[model samples]
Target: MKAVSELLKKHDGTLWHVTPAMTVFEAVEQLARLEVGALLVMDGDRLAGVFSERDYTRKITLLGRNSRETLVSEIMTANVITVNATTRTRECMSLMSARKIRHLPVVEGERVLGMISIRDIMDDIISDHEHTIASLESYIQS
Candidate 1:
């Protein structure tokens, strides 16, 4: 099975991030503009935390925090669970499921490579199953 590294080979290893002090509202706007579900919080290119729409809804909105006043750092997931490029898709699924996180930063050494989403794994799983089923049906017909 191909790994996350293979999945990211075409992504140019570009990771979108925002400043820690950015307001939650600003982050949400960027998220909408970028059409991404999450953004990494960076401190001089160092991974600080992650901001997700879920964070805004759950930690800010539900908690009665002001989005324009609340900094993303205040609601970001500080304890980020990262995955290595070499990690398998199945492993990624397992980690995401266990932690209940949808996004994972893909790292190689001290540098961030890319981000992976649960949807990525789900698509890979579905594609693989379809291929396998097709191969089985072909064999049975022959």
Candidate 2:
């Protein structure tokens, strides 16, 4: 039942982003440098879309597009899915599963807060389970 804000608290609130006009090669470099799977494509403070490894593979590599020439806007997923700080972790998991997406931007009325990945939610769930198991064991020993 932890809120998205609670989860984000554990992470460095860094919203990694790239402009839509950025070349795919540059974006890929940023992705590799940041060690992240996706980057929020931003136009100033607005959320433009998302450019991910999936986009690169499907739109660039498979199509033999030149990464150095192609722009992120051309291959980025335009219709982005976002959540707010108050959204629960379970809801996020369900939404990601239903939408078949790996990354979600946390927004507050148009202001981008941070990004959350499927891996983040899974790690939180595993941690919660471990805590619950420990609590139950402690109770049983009492």
Candidate 3:
């Protein structure tokens, strides 16, 4: 299995994020502008939390809170599940599946690298399978 580092290399290297003090409305706008499902909540250089569409839907919409007034820090998922560059893509997939999470931040020590989505894991798995199938077919032809 390819390491998460490989996937990171393939990415555009954009660490989409927002400040914890930002309003949910502002954060949501950033999410839409970046075309991402989640945004890493940064408290200066520290990784504070993660704000996602699910957070907005469950905490704001269901609770009848005002997104314009509510802070991202108030509703963001603070206990973030992260992976290091050395972690395998398969492991990331398993973690996401078990946690019912769609996004995972890649970190090293306390420094955040980037984020990966379930889509990234799926693409890696699919690509690996296709490569394996082609190799098998080539072997048979030989």
Candidate 4:
């Protein structure tokens, strides 16, 4: 399995983020603009939390809180689960499945690397499977 670092290298290294003090409305706008399901909540260079569509729905919509008035920090998931660059994609898949989460922030010590989603993991898995199958077919032909 490929390491998380390899996967990050495949895509443009753009760490999309929102400040904790930003209003939920502003964060939501960023989400919409980026067409992403989540955004890392960063306090300067430090990761503070994660804000996602689920967080907005459950915390603001279901709770009847006003997004325009509420801060991202108030609704973001503070207990974020992270993975290091060396972590394998399969390990990340397992973590995401066990936690029932779609996004994970990749960090090393205090520095944030990037974020990965279920989509990224699934794509990697599918690619791996395809490669294996192709290898098997080639071996059989040989």
lDDT of the candidates, in the order given:
0.89, 0.94, 0.93, 0.96
Per-residue lDDT of model 3, residues 2-58, tens digit only: 999899887778778999899999999998998889989999878999999999999
What clash pairs does model 1 have?
none
> Which stretches of candidate 3 lie above 4 Å from their native place?
none
**Candidate 2 lDDT trough over 10 residues, lowest sum:** 6-15
Model 1 per-residue lDDT tens digits across residues 43-133: 8868888999999999987999999999988899999999998999999998899989999998887788888888888988998999999
Write one digit per residue (lDDT tens) for candidate 4, span 75-106: 99999999999999999999999999999999
* Residue 109 shift from truth in candidate 1, angstroms: 1.9
Instruction: Give the CA lDDT, 0 to 100, for residue 134 in model 3.
Output: 100
Clashing pairs in 3: none
RMSD of each: 1.3, 0.8, 0.8, 0.7
How many clashes in candidate 3? 0
Better of 3 and 4 by lDDT: 4
Off by over 4 Å in 4: none
Q: After superposition, how far is residue 130 of candidate 1 from its true place, in Å?
A: 1.4
Best by TM-score: 4
